[model samples]
Target chain A: MENDDTEYPVRYIPASKVLQAKVPFLDVSPNIALKKANNVLEEMAKDYVNWVQEDIKRLESTYQDLCEDPKSKDAITALYRVSYAMKGQGGTFGYDLVTFILNNLCRYLEEREEFNEGQLELIELHIESVRMVITHELTGKGGEMGKQVIMGLKQMINKKG
Target chain B: MSAKMLDLSNINILIIDENANMRIIVKQILRALDAHTTKEASGGAEAFTTLKTFNADIILTTWMMSPINGVEFTKMLRTSSDSPNPMVPVIMLSGHTEARYISEARDSGVTEFMAIPISPKSLYLRIAEVVLRPRQFVQTNDFFGPDRHRHDNEKYRGELRRQEDKEKQQDEMELTDAHNSLLKPD
Candidate 1:
């Protein structure tokens, strides 16, 4: 390798050994660690059914606030943050539809401003769809209805965008 | 190494997110992995305070936060003179997996980006990568943090650039030439 030592503003620090010394690789099977972790998530999923309702309520209230003041950039951004949480949690709890819906919503909200009537309505439709999924315990793919809801949302996103 | 298990219990890890529930979820997952020492903070400010004494080896943070967000927190960790464990690996957690969001986190010095709705497998993989394959840290006039490049002749790790960086890099080449002269066969 050429020593391109330009008197550059860059300074390179060697990789830190502070953590490595403590987290050394051991002979234990990776499967054991993975199994333990999966167990934890499986346990959490049980309560996720109840916890997700609060998230939906927060999502609804944020949407309502955005509806009241469509011009408020903060309101729109806050709404997105609420959706962000749901997007992360939904899949872990078997609410893949919620994850899918909120994931799409976050993309729409990213750097988005000026929510026209159609856009707002579309947003509302998404929230309601998510609510329906959770309320019905539509876990895996939500079967046929899940397909329809996801397809409908995609179409609306195209039109709204 | 492939057959070996990762030991997370020996090292301290920090969880920083505004959402309490997310913190719990991450903590539980870490616990399952046998992580014995872990700390939690509500947001960036709390994270800084926690850093004062915790000496965390890894930091898992959320993207969107009130007051000071993940990006802001990362910049501080990389640049702040008083920052505790400034070289600690930062893994950003965000449900928004958009390129822009991930790029933004990377630009600000995140060591790893984990798009959320996270699974135990994905989470474990991320932790394993950061632990097993730590990246070199790079500091420049404009940015300071983990070298962004995974490979390639130590390329400039920062995306944010200035006219001066170009000029400064030119100066670096001149210095490199001078240093190379010592290696020449006379």
Candidate 2:
């Protein structure tokens, strides 16, 4: 009989050893640990909120430059980077609305090889939406207002597409 | 296996993501899972450097990053001679769950795929799967990664059903020969 189990040799980390180590972080938290964890995460997310606000300001300034010169690829590139970062960070920080807004922005920017006036306007709207989401600290895909904003943006994006 | 039976305290996890907040969130989840020793890297290059110094039991990385993405990093880990640990299980985290993206990550040797907005339970389940029921590693001329097949079903007929039995036998012989050629000499 052929040895069907013949396989490559690889070092396997034993689960027993891992289970033996002490987890101090978990020990300190009481029941409702996830909520406690969320509180801590919320505190940490505040710092990122400040950073995103600053980045949004930068995006606004860059948008101004693009307005003066549509061919300012640098501004567009900068805009894309800020939006892309926000898209990745929003949901992680419990700001799913920000993630949703930036996700649309990032997808729009990614699809375009170049930015024209109409596309630039769309980008501005997306940026403003992101700014609003962060400014309000809207979490979990904003309530009714968030849905309206997202729907509005989606309509514009689809029309553009 | 239940999560209660699995212990993750001693596990050293390395999380690589371009976004700082994402790294922080993932760390919190790991800590919630009773994982004490965790490391963070902002990008793949930094992760590669960290791997050389800190031996991680498993890796959780994002799919998109500048200069070096998760797929590129996984390829290097699997194929690069200088890799610190080629066989360490890797779980790729991404907001993009498009089929193509998942397929790309899977093809790059990732052991598991996790979508963003991950809950602690989902993350723990993935960890348990990797630690408890790891897939056998496969090595071939063009591939070196975990076997994609996880279940054995006698009723499930694969693509071989399209071919005659005799042709399938011939194909199996050729595959066996190819696999043998990849093995190291004694």
Candidate 3:
């Protein structure tokens, strides 16, 4: 195994010096041509919906197993992986509501030391919120209702902790 | 030259993400930047195989991929004798912004870290940062990757400024000595 003290024979140039000396300005023009990119993203998102629904179903079943056997690390890890993927992809595909819910869910899971009834309920609520987001096609406009759901979930998590 | 004038048409980028949708999003963004020759890998294991033939100029990968995660892949790319180009720059993508995760990616040999929900501007900035202002690679017994420190802006003043300056000067002198020795008539 490699340790921190291992040394190699190379000198590094700092990014700051290179930026100052070589490239002072980074100019990126907004590509007007790619403005229609959103339409393409929407189409791809439509296809992703089916996959995401299937993932949710799997998560729901996993949650049930967790409730039955709370000590199952595999169930928690499986739930986390699916939620983590959704957390990363939802906003990119224009499903910001899903992203919002999943991001919080992932955070909660990360902070979890043990799975309890309260935690399970919160997870269930989060899963249901995701379902609602998908079924309603809640993109960026999940506004008030979405905010309330997130707020309620947060309160529940906080109260339990 | 400004980023606008910089032509990425000649640059070949390899994007490694588990999600097909992510690959599509990244490809579109790179296309907008005028990078036409882009390749995609479903996961890290496939990325290693693709690199054998793709000869990619830069690699953009996600933090979490099945079979082989980004950190493990980066370690292999940096140290494995079989690596096609061990020094090829790597940029890690992820939604997790926690300091621990960022620090982990840095230690694992990633050249850059980009957060998810990436905007065009942010993506362009990261690309420009890597290409225009490349960091020097460091090779340690345990690590072979870009230097961790990135900022050189004059506006910022921190407590470690003087110490960092001294370390940098010492490093430069050592490098000069080594170079001079190489040129000596022995």
Candidate 4:
């Protein structure tokens, strides 16, 4: 392909000095800074439990909305949005099982413009599993129960495929 | 994990996300970093409104959002006359790890990309990159954002290639050779 760079005149503006002036370069040790930051994250994790509870409720309601009217894009989007939000937060607080379950659901939703009966069922099952995870304070992989839940979800997805 | 310590005490950041939980988590982390100020917005449109007075040195936005997504918001910020600062660095936070999604975000003028469940260390490193080693902004007929070429491609001859950049690279290489020779007398 022939390159025509003349169409747009390019100019480069060096931006480092300007940004450096605003963002201070500290002498503080990284280990100490990270420790403080992690402490803050840990403090925030306390809220995550309650937050995920509300999120599960939101997921359950979204599922209900989809069930009542499977053709509604709004419900589907809401379902997807909630799942995606949960996936991003769960890992920070040791709720990796929630993230693992929802990651699959998010992918499924991403590929779908519309839902089918089995699709809705799959989504419902995911929502239920996450609800279980949250309700039981099931963090990390959720141990044996988590493994079983993940395996079951995978089997359902494979069956659909 | 990085060695550099940042004094975030003077930096003001704007965070835009549709998820409340995300906003809470990010704001908490930013505060923990001692960011001088942070203004939160639920989505891109609200972020635009907040930008009118926020004086944000950096923007952290989620890739997917309602009302206006991060890509659209970035394009407008880079081009819009009303944008408070056209050249402000934007670090896009995302859950979507698809290649296409990342490419779209980059093309739309995001300065950096981070897949979320953001840890303090990862977030700080990104902040440090933008501040300590900022890329030059490039303006043209179509795009007005950071220079997309993060490193020089010496093999390809292009109309826009700078001779100065080639010379700079050669000088650095020679300097490295000299330093290596000094370190090893053999």
lDDT, candidate 2, B1-186, per-residue tens:
111234567778999988776777789877865677999999888998999999888899987787898999999898898998888889988766766777788789898887766655456656655665466666665667766555434234344434546455322112222222222132
Model 3 spans with C-alpha error above 4 angstroms: A1-30, A33-39, A42-51, B1-5, B151-186
DockQ of model 1, rounded to 2 decimals:
0.40
TM-score of chain B of 1: 0.79
Please, what is the whole-model Cα lDDT of each candidate in the order they appear? 0.79, 0.70, 0.71, 0.78
For residues B27-70, what per-residue lDDT tens digits would candidate 1 score against the true structure? Answer: 88888888879999988888999999998888999888888999
iRMS of each prediction in angstroms?
A: 10.5, 12.2, 12.2, 6.6
C-alpha DockQ for predicted model 3: 0.20
Q: In candidate 4, what are the lDDT values of residues B13-62, reduced to their tens digit?
A: 99999988888888877777788488899887788889988888899999
DockQ of 2: 0.13
Question: lDDT-based ranking, best first?
Answer: 1, 4, 3, 2
Ten contiguous residues minimizing lDDT sum, candidate 3 chain A: A17-26
Per-residue CA lDDT of model 3 for A1-161, tens digit only, reads 12253344444533334233433322443343234444555666777778788778877987787788877877777787778777777887778888888888888777765687877888898898889888877777477776776677778778864
- Give the CA lDDT, 0 to 100, for residue B178 in model 2: 20
DockQ for every prediction shown:
0.40, 0.13, 0.20, 0.41
Q: How close to the true structure is residue A80 of candidate 1, measured as C-alpha lDDT?
A: 88
Question: Which of the numbered candidates is closest to the native, going by highest lDDT?
Answer: 1
lDDT of 4 by residue, A19-117 (tens): 788766555555576678789888878777786778888898988998888888898888888888899999877788888889889898878877788
